[model samples]
Target: MLCFRFCPVPRLELVLLCLVLGAARSCALELNLTNSEKATCLYAKWQMNFTIHYETTNKTYKTATISDHDNVTYNGSICDDDHNVSKIAVQFGSGFSWIVNFTKQEPNYFIDSISFSYNTEDNITFPGAKDKGIVTVHYSEKVSIPLNDIFRCSSLLTYEENHVVQHYWDVLVQAFVQNGTVSRKEFLCTKDKGSTTVAPIIHTTVPSPTTTPTPKEKPQVGNYSVSNGNTTCLLATMGLQLNITQDKIASVININPNSTGFTGSCQPQTAQLRLNSSIIKYLDFVFAVKNENRFYLKEVNASIYLANGSVFSIANNNLSYWDAPLGSSYMCNKEQTLSVSGTFQINTFNLKVQPFNVTEGKYSTAQECSLDDDTILIPIIVGAGLSGLIIVIVIAYLIGRRKSYAGYQTL
Candidate 1:
């Protein structure tokens, strides 16, 4: 079973071997300089799109184009276990050089610090040509940008060659450098590039409530009247007529004599009445004598005199002979006066009486009356003898009473 002896590799040799492997894995690569010549042999442009981040700044997305160049190189590599990179250098052919530092290393990509240098061409000298500057591409995890902020980028170079002419090459490099940032200030892209629209705001206002007044009656018109006694009796009447074509008699009063003589041997017979001028249109007065107590129902003779000087008489001796009569008298002995008055109607009339015979055992007396001044007034009169008797009685009473008191003795 035995006879197997194992020899350990030397530390130095193992180290060397590891270094060789690492170097092999980290070997810098150069892209074929003439790979794009089949498409266009003339000087052409190139663009790079990338995203980056820095510990002190925010994430950024950028696009850059190289407009002018004769040659360029793109070089990058991952760091090794020792944080050392074998391709941590950039070579601008024809003796130009730059130092590079790998800041990040991932499974498929890396970010690096860049240094710059210049190389001279044999016969061509680009005016103001010092050296193209180095641009650092920091690594980032994000692929998008904010709407209001800006994304910035440094200039970068890409290289190509002409296969048709050996040793002829071209470099695409940015002609102008933008040292600052670019803003994401554009309106959002839409499916239809030709159309754009904005929404409108709707506003409304409320209204207040309002108030709304109420609607008065008319008066009625009527009539009134009064009367007091025979002889000096007074009467007044009042009324309202809306549409009166002819005259309206609102009140009337009359008196007549019975067939029993109105006079006796000792006194003269008399009767009196008054009426309202305000309510009556026409009025007349007359008197007569009849044989019965129901004289007003018996036949009689009479004459009527109106305030207008109109004379009306009834000689038939019939009780109804008088145009209008007081309650129970058969004869209209005298014509009486009637007065009518109001805002719309006014009138007046008179009455007179004559006694033909007298009997001695009876005496006749006269009455006195007053009327409403506001409405109307009417007065009736007998012979002047009765009036004279009234005055004589008043005077004699005063004089005899004075004389008797003066002669009287006090106890």
Candidate 2:
């Protein structure tokens, strides 16, 4: 037996609660729909990547990314009897939902639009935007059609309102299938055939002061990627560190994305990657292409919540690090530090990134960072010095062996 009880909450709240409850029961990463004949099948699998830039109370910019499905609590689908239209809703995180509407015309099914709903009450995620109330990022344009096989798109969809909330979406979806099952062919959206470029490197954070550091422990390298279909568009591998001042005491934070949430978005001209945790509210790195041929890290935005209940914000846009050609990556095997702001410093070790024109799911060519030029020259200089020393030693030895014996009278 099922029991029902009515709460006295506001109508809007009640509706939202019901929707959430429904999603909790049906939330799933994959959705399967069958026609009345039961012989035809429609399958949909999507990986959604969202980049949100919001404002704080002090008029500072803050960014957040929602790409991890671990927080997804609800998923539901509705289709008409004739299967002409289908709607799917996925709710994740706190007060956030994505609704996708699909329409089928004859032999093809097309995505009509996608609507993103976010609640401003979640101060932890939308801190200063509390006064904005409910916000929606909608894309009404029709993407492509013919979902019979695999349909994929990774284009950056930008939506902004009042310069307060800016949303960039990178969606990879495959819906509407008449084949018996999903095909095993490699994804053709990009040159890659998988979602990741290399085996992701997982690094644990450094132990606390009281704990002894392990001798074999290496610094964590954050491997972040944004993919659509089987092709990864943005890939970055680097060890991230944050230097900040707390209570006038300087401290360093080694960002270990292995134990935190990491998300990003990829586009042709620009890309973004963000790391989020309780201690570090959000660390966002933005990359952009310039002069249509070169690409570089354009800026970094962050909001740090300290242990002393104080908040530190970083909004630095005057940065141009790790520059390379559009078809190549930037490599820096040595540690590179940038003063993101007067009070905040960012450090990256063994950094390699390719944000545009990636090929075969890997970096095409590498352009060494200018900062690493000296590092590249150290080996050459040392080798030259060693050769010179060896020649001198050989000459000295020959001279000594060939010298006249001063003490030998028989010579």
Candidate 3:
């Protein structure tokens, strides 16, 4: 039993309490009791979602309902905290409806009467209403009477608005009173008997809902390491080939005229080589706090060496529109790969995408043996040859002069 302290309310508290709450609101739970006749103690742990606006915090019922457990007895000294207790929101014989938690009020209040009432209407509305059937109040408020009436409480607080129905529902909290303080507090709630939905009017019979499973992420392309003998088919499709060992720089992978396997729509074996290297490098490449578009390489400024020792760089070497191929393109999918515009090309030459440092996208260049300004060998050789030729001509000229003089003397 519980005793409630009664006192005069300073405000004109009537009609719907929520109507005067301005922007705030309240509600009561729709309960369905296993045993309505028996006065069994109910325990409930309800969850609510709160919306904080600048100063005020308003709470709303979530999709989940109160987890009701059996046999939770009243606990405390009556009205000790005065945190619980609300006005009669609904009228007597008010059928199944939404429950509401009235905003906490001051002063004090007592329970004059705690009873359950039920009434069924058959206006072609209430579900399972077979020409107005008997729908007993399965769930309702159960206010505990004080074991020891310390206040000698009599003029019980007016059942102001407990019967008034709301669109939502909330748990009802009533406390067992002592002299002035609350000794024990117990929670009560109306069970949802008919539908999972909360409404002013009882909704129709709702079927159990089916849950949807979350989707799994697609696996990114991966790599494999092998020798040339193992990949006879790969060599046929790809014009050029590159191989990189994990963590170690096995060899500088160069793009050549033949690396066209990646230029077509991603087939199982179509783009396998490029797929393998890029994926393996991505795993090894680490940019802890990097964005997808963050630059790895500013400019690919290096001469590429082909298999036959032919060296060349990208003709124009455009970096303005260079997109860091960091993450997989959105069009690239696992099940059915998309057809791309192939690779960069001019005339019949298909441009090769050189293997880059996964993080830096750095490319390597081959040093062609062009004329060097550092060496003086060419100048030295030319100077020696010209001096020798000049000396030979001078000797021949002197010999001719000697021969003419000798001929004159002989005459």
lDDT scores of the candidates, listed in order = 0.23, 0.60, 0.25
Which stretches of model 3 miss by more than 4 angstroms?
1-16, 19-118, 124-128, 137-172, 182-411
lDDT of 2 at 275: 74
lDDT string, candidate 3, 1-411, tens digits:
122222222221111121111111212122211112222112121211111001001211111111121122111112222345333333312242223222223333344433322233533222232234333222333333333322211110112122111122233333222332333443222234322444332111121233211222332232222123223221111122232221111222332222111211122211222221111111111111125332221222222222111222332223222123432211111132111112212111112221222223322231111222236687889999999999999999999999999999999
User: Which candidate tops TM-score?
Assistant: 2
Instruction: List the RMSD of every prediction in angstroms.
Output: 59.3, 16.8, 29.4
Q: What is the lDDT of residue 143 in candidate 2?
A: 52
Clashes of each: 37, 2, 48
Candidate 1 regions off by >4 Å?
Answer: 1-79, 84-86, 104-110, 120-123, 126-411
If scored against the real structure, what TM-score would every candidate get? 0.15, 0.41, 0.17
TM-score of 1: 0.15
Q: How far is candidate 1 from the true structure (C-alpha RMSD, Å)?
A: 59.3
